[model samples]
Target: MKKKSTHLRALEGKSKSEKKKIRKEFEEVKERLEKAQAKYVQKPKRQKATTSKAENKKWEQKRKDRYNQRVWKGWRDKDMEEYPVKTYNIKDIEKDT
Candidate 1:
């Protein structure tokens, strides 16, 4: 069987200068990537919300007014003129309870 070469074995153990060169190259590559990323990254545009406070307040007021009008209409329809007021004694309710 053939034996492995000494040069290949020597290449497995890097010299001090070779290690330093590799470390410096890695550092340079990292710095270059950081600079390129900084240049390419973009800021997002601002978005406006759908419902502003003033519009919400206006809608809420209109809803409340509509609810109040419906309640008033029912009260008027039930009690205004055609339907006569009926009186009941409190004792009758207590007896039923």
Candidate 2:
């Protein structure tokens, strides 16, 4: 059999009234710990509703306006330029090669 700890031996030597007081304090601490844990437990958050057709259209228009503003700003800052499209004939290039 395992030997009892010194603390256990000391506790065993205490009077009944002292033991009862210690037991009551232990119960109170246990109850308090349970209450604290319950208080901190996370609740599920409510989800947002899906956007309606009108809301989606509004968002799309806002996006287009934002893009146009950015393009205009770039043109004003001389950061935007227009280039002419160049077309190539594959047969003509092959004949040259």
Candidate 3:
């Protein structure tokens, strides 16, 4: 049988010190989590106003109609042939050698 490498043997079974340290760390984390959960347990339940499906549909339709009306009002009788031109030039400057 081949002899096990030191790294494999060390990692396969943790020493007592390493186990105790890991357990302590886990316990501390658990304690913190419990405290955090306890702190949030008494928080006020938010009363979100629930609108009905019909009301939601009505609101969405009203918004869409308003948007369409505004778009039609903005573009009606506007000249489609006259597009604006860019007024500035963006040429790269020559670098001094």
Candidate 4:
């Protein structure tokens, strides 16, 4: 027959109440270890939904329209600059006449 381990021998020497207490404590420690492992385990990444070419083109056009309306107010790039207007002086025109 195989000899019992010192730890097992010690546990065998304990009363029923002591054994029950030890078992309960062991269960609590096991539960804690499982919870810690679950907390540290890496979860799988979620996949993004793929859009069709027509859907992408429609979204792109909508985005462009919104950007043009919000940022440029339907004006083109060339019309957005601040140009200086030529003003005529009345005194200078009379003196010249």
Candidate 5:
């Protein structure tokens, strides 16, 4: 990796080998994301439905949304694994006021 700029977040104070491993894992995730995204070449067009059909579709949509939330959580968990962090103290944060 190139010498990091001051603006970037430093690794979790781990050894260079461990940091490299994390970086490799993240790169793999990025590649997998790119490959998965390639399957969707264009935006999905929504279909218009009648009143009752729309009502039933709404419940099905809620179900799909709940399933997608788990996928979102999986992505978040992978990110935190690579950049495992410690909580900051209030004093450490710069005040905006």
Candidate 6:
């Protein structure tokens, strides 16, 4: 049983002084608990940032590479050999450097 419950049960048939002593002990336990809880700050909810930073960074890199592939293709020249991304792999170009 919890200290609070034990202390509460102790109150039955006790003198007024003893009841006051148990109540004081309960207050001390409450204070110690408050102190322990105050040591840690709560983190912000993930819902605020739907995606984590690393995931966002990875997605942005992929999107940039995709757009870059399209930009590399001469969009104006009407030669449809294949889509830019399918024709050239981004990682292959990066590996050269």
Query: Which candidate achieves the best lDDT against the true structure?
Result: 6
Measured on C-alpha atoms, candidate 2 has an lDDT of 0.79
Worst 10 residues of 4 by lDDT: 76-85
List pairs with backbone clashes in candidate 3: none
The stretch of ten residues in a row with the least summed lDDT in candidate 2 is 77-86
The TM-scores, one per candidate, come to 0.46, 0.36, 0.31, 0.43, 0.33, 0.36
Each prediction's whole-model lDDT (CA): 0.79, 0.79, 0.71, 0.78, 0.75, 0.82
Give the candidate order by descending lDDT.
Answer: 6, 2, 1, 4, 5, 3
| RMSD list, candidates in order | 10.5, 10.6, 22.0, 13.3, 33.9, 13.8
lDDT of 6 by residue, 1-97 (tens): 6456676788999999999998998999999999999889686766676789999999999999998777767753566744544566899999998
- How many collisions per candidate? 0, 0, 0, 0, 0, 0
Report model 2's TM-score to 2 decimal places. Answer: 0.36
Best by TM-score: 1
What does candidate 3's lDDT look like per residue over 1-97, in tens digits? 9989644455457888886776787779989999989977887889986998899999999999998777666555474423333354445333422
Candidate 5 structure quality by residue, lDDT tens digits, 41-96: 78788987656977899999999999877766776688864334458778768663
TM-score of candidate 5 to 2 decimals: 0.33
Q: List the residue pairs that clash in candidate 4.
A: none
By lDDT, the better pick of 2 and 3 is: 2
**What order do candidates take by TM-score, descending?**
1, 4, 6, 2, 5, 3
Across residues 14-72, which tens digit of lDDT does each residue of candidate 4 receive?
89999888778877998999999999899998988689889999999999989766666
